[model samples]
Target: MANSPQPPLDALYQEALATFDTLLSQARGEGDPEPTAMTLASVEGARVSARIVLLKGVDARGFRFFTNYRSSKGEQLAAHPQAALCFHWKTLRNGVQVRVEGRVATLEAAESDEYFATRPRASQIGAWASAQSQTLADRAEFEARIDEFERRFECVPVPRPPHWGGFVLAPDRIEFWYGADFRLHERQCYERDADGAWSRRMLYP
Candidate 1:
């Protein structure tokens, strides 16, 4: 059978956005506590690392998440601005997977501050107390830091740490996969061109 026609770049992006919204809603309706969680992969030289991070936001611009600027992933991103993200929704009866390859950039101070303000008070304090990806002498040392920050910020809003902020992954390529019977999955892959136009094609499972 012949393949289906692909939509134009802008239209295809809109379709992808709609699909994402549907999948996210479905995931939540199915009782997934963290629907926005995704696997983020970063690399440094030959070393690669992957971790789960909650998606803070997504828009026409890109996907955004926050982390410690001095952490391992932060340093790696500084050296190599490209990274990959994977979202697997297993809560639904029919699983869905989304993959993105993108270039990362730090958000502006104001943007970071705005997002930080929305975080829970404890999380905001933790961001200041924990030196992410750093060695701690002991559990007590970490707890002491948290206590110190808690006391220091008492009766005041915990300010966003200077090293804690948001990063955006502006995707150049994205692939959506839907599971099927007999291992014959459906794949739609989109790639952005030099002129910043997106083109999509279907791929075999």
Candidate 2:
């Protein structure tokens, strides 16, 4: 079934994704820098951590990002296999906030390799040099590791780290919120079904 024609994405899903694209574009036009930045929240047991991560890609399947497999967030995702993302574009007319809840899974090795190849040489080096989310004795030790990797990869292409790759979140629910005057905001929620269909509804603000 290689290269076989695949069925189209669910119509409602496509429409909702297109709306996100339009809003992202509008945020760009409104001069909001870093439109793709989203707050990525992951949990480990009863502990939760939230940090900002840039959205690398998005499609009907879901959102994509890359990180060290051994990092705190990555380990959290490994343990829970679920996460949430929040995107707020403050520069848009009034403002817009989008929240996503989803299950996470590792991306294919080939896809990870393709994206890794496009990274800058320095960043590629960092990927190997960093022991992400691990305690360090000092800053000097980290810089020394970077220097070591740089020398090791000199005159050669840096390969993607085995412990580093990509993850995709297949969203089960997506919510869009718009700011309005007098606190009468607009909220739209879209929930996906097991059969890949979507149901959408408006929520009271």
Candidate 3:
């Protein structure tokens, strides 16, 4: 039930974030056996592109995700330096969108090394095999590359690719949306202030 009188913007934003986290947990226990991943968007002049990538880490400071540093998103981010992330939980009919304007750079080599060592052997090998965002001749060629990498690194620990790593998006603004009957959805937005604190606002439905 809606609060008979809507609460303050900060309260509303916090409440929506809590609800979204709860719904995400419920979604995880349902049909999808995958981890919570988000579609990351980056721009190039008039073009925008996005792809699903795993959520690697998060904190009050930022959200982090790892990928091949030579991938499409990487290239786009290198040029534009800002990106957005969207997480849609269809089962819950809810979504969270965050617009982050921050500098993008590779994670420390040690950070990447530690994470890579924790990944499954096959994924590590695949990381080396893939020339991410580059077109391959065919499926066979990709498989052949993977096979070659596997053979060359057999009985040895696969090292993290120099061209693969993580990016932390320091969000300047984050919006949480909840769908309601009659299309009067609930929306709460948080914007970072000059003092480095976040100010919350409620948008008209």
Of the candidates shown, which would achieve the greatest lDDT relative to the real structure?
2
lDDT by candidate, in order shown? 0.90, 0.93, 0.74
Badly placed stretches (over 4 Å) of model 3 are 1-23, 29-35, 93-103
Error of 2 at 103 (Å): 0.9
Error of 2 at 152 (Å): 0.3
Q: What's the count of clashing pairs in each model shown?
A: 0, 0, 0
Candidate 1 has its poorest 10 consecutive residues by lDDT at: 6-15
The TM-score, computed over Cα atoms with residue i paired to residue i, of candidate 1 is 0.92
TM-score for each of the candidates: 0.92, 0.95, 0.82
lDDT of 1 by residue, 149-200 (tens): 9999999999999999999999888898999889899999988888878789
Model 1 has a clash total of 0
The candidate that wins on TM-score is 2
Q: Which model, 1 or 3, shows the larger TM-score?
A: 1
Stretches off by above 4 angstroms in model 1 are 1-9
Question: Model 3, 1-205: lDDT tens per residue?
Answer: 7759743445433554465467567777665455477888888888999888887766543677888878888888888878888776656654333333444555678877888889999999999999998999899999999999999999998888888888888766777777777878888777767655567788987
Pairs that collide in candidate 3 are none
